[model samples]
Target: MIKKAVIGVLCAGIALGIGIVIGHFGISSGPSWLKDVAKDVDESFIERFMAEVNTIQIQENLRELTDVPHMATTAGDEKTVQTMLRRWLDDDDGLDDAWREEYNVYLSFPDANNPNKVTVVDAANVVKHSIREKEKPYTDDQRDPDVVQPYAAYSPAGHVKGKLVYANQGKPSDYEELSKKVNLTGTIAITRYGGAGRGAKAINAAPYGVAGVLVYTDPQDINDGFMSDTNETYPHSWYLPPSGVERGSFNRDFGDLLTPYLAAKEETYRIPPENIVGIPPIPIQPIGFEDAYVLICALDGDAAPFAWQGAFNCTYNLGGPGFKPTSAFSNSDVKMDIYNQEVIKNSANVMGIIRGSVEPDRYVIYGNHRDSWVHGAIDPSSGTSVMLEITRVLGRMVKQGIWRPRRSIIFGSWGAEEFGLIGSAEYTEVISCSSFSLTLHGCSYTLEKQMFRLNKTY
Candidate 1:
């Protein structure tokens, strides 16, 4: 009986060894003799593809894309356009197809020769103090000539001066509270940045009789009041330096400002400049916190309510509508001189496609703006880098016929996005106006973060 049991155990052990060998081979080679037993995970191609995608390629894409500051319509932007085209059109590892779309979009720029500025002028109209037109240049990136001085884009170019009022965030409620305390008319509200859209900062102030707006980043709000000095900020730590002003489009809507309903083709009908709305009617500019500290400290009036106060050392005040008696800016008014201009320029949208094997007409579009306010290392370039890597991996695979998506994949590098989604918006108008134009007067596209995707069924 003992000898019979030993023979049965030996036979069972040999069967187990054979099963293990077949399982290993099935996993390695995919759909092998043991496929039925392994349930056919079909993970071989997926494993190979994921292995090919690595950090080094992603970093390389970032390094190449951000080599220069590529604001829309600038020469630097053209370079980036070429880079995308070259990559997508490469013979060996390129997409199935790639092309460029051009649109004549309206854009804004600060006068390069005559920079925008905020100043304190004496009652006699003599300039007493002027905030620095540009941030303190610490590195080559900051000092780059292409780094445009911080200014409110699309703010009508004009010079206006009035009493300085600390209107927190320049929201409508803020203006209402300040107006109840003191007259807000003919004042240049030095609003700290937050709680409102950049353009709304000025637009909300307009009805309260605020003539102009000077927006700035408060260290408390932006940096959590960790540190205000240059040493404690960027290049040293994560905080923004005192001179780092947040620059952005001050316009209210998306798409080409000139061609609202139509595609921004060269021959598209454009609305007259005077017909435009949703922009600050008054001149506006953004200043650094260092300059804001100087302006706010000079304000003399009743202390603001606790909620309106920020992390500044001094008590936030409803301006005496001017300056403190003890301040050097006494009897002086704040001045905002903005020399911004608007013009129609050609912006490029680089579009690439990977045709699907099953549903060729259906599409999944992945895109990021290629333009920046400055180097825009964070705003858009970071997303652009990740997108480039994705295309590289998928493009190579498609080129070699390793795998194909079920639906078409469209990669778009949009332009003039910093100016308010001009590239993507105009493209939408061209594609969707036939259907959405009659039902919806306007189509709004909001980018959730630096990147967004759309699945187009039609």
Candidate 2:
């Protein structure tokens, strides 16, 4: 009986040894074997694709795209679109397809023919300040003479002169207070940027019968460092310097002004002129605070409400026709004269598509406005660089057979966003228009989720 038991134990030990050897050698068969094979393929492709995204590429792309100013509707803007197209074509990630979608849309632009002028004069009619906000230097390569001046896009074209009235921020409530203090009719409104949209300031003043508007960046609104004499500017800190003027659109009504619910195409019907809530009739100009101070210091009336006071050394006041003299304008009239020329032209929108494997009808859209007020390094170029980089990575994954997204991805390089979202709004209008909807099968799109997908592990 003992001999038989010992043999049994030896057989059990041999079986365990064989099992260990098989497992170590990966000799297992069936579904587990297939899973191991699949996992190895995924790991190799994942690492390779991730390695494709790097700082060197990102830096190179940013510098290349931002090397020139590409404001919407300019020759530079078209060139920028072509450059982006070239990059997409040059990509080696084995994309399924690439192309551009062109739309003929109306864009508002400023040129030599259609221009704006803002002049500050004394009672003598001598020009005290004649400089309107022009494109100034931010970097060695950013200055472009053809770049549009600091006029509010879509502002009415007219020449009007009136007494300079210091209206704090030119918001609705500020005007409400001014109406209580003095008559606001026919006076030019002087306001600093803040408290409201720049366009809203102009719109609010129209009801008060103001002749024109002046928008500026007050030192009080800027940071302590920007207002200080000693501080680093751009390429060092993000703080805005004194000379820097913030440029933006003030199209009051929602969506595209030219083509609201319908696309801005020759074939589409447009709303009547009276029905159209388009450009404000008042002439509006945006100036740097340096120019603004020359006028703000000349203001005189009752002491401005405590909240109305700015960082300026002089006390803020609501100046109008009857105000008493306190400064340079004490003995003379402070007047503002403005002229604006509004032009309309055709602009384009560039788009790229990556079809999905499962749900091609649905989409994951990524967009960045490629147009800029200047070089747009911070506004849109930075975001454009990121979008391009993402395309490369996803392309690699698709080529390596590692990822197959459930929804299609569409990359849009929008134009004219700085001009009150013209490019995007027009695009939306085309999508919903009866004639245009036939192509998209009446597809409905929504901004379901938004994410800032960039951050360093460090």
Give the number of the best model, judged by TM-score: 1
C-alpha lDDT of candidate 1 relative to the true structure: 0.83
| Steric clash pairs (candidate 2) | none
lDDT, residue 321, candidate 1: 89
Model 2 lDDT tens row, 69-169:
78877778888888778766555663455555555454445446545667656667776566545644655564666566776776766677777778888
Candidate 1: C-alpha RMSD to true structure equals: 9.7
Candidate 2, number of clashes = 0
Q: In model 2, which runs have C-alpha deviations exceeding 4 angstroms?
A: 1-50, 113-115, 135-139, 228-236, 272-275, 320-326, 331-339, 432-458
Model 1, C-alpha of 224: deviation from truth (Å):
1.2
The runs of at least 3 residues in candidate 1 whose Cα sits more than 4 Å from the true structure, single-residue gaps closed, are 1-43, 432-458
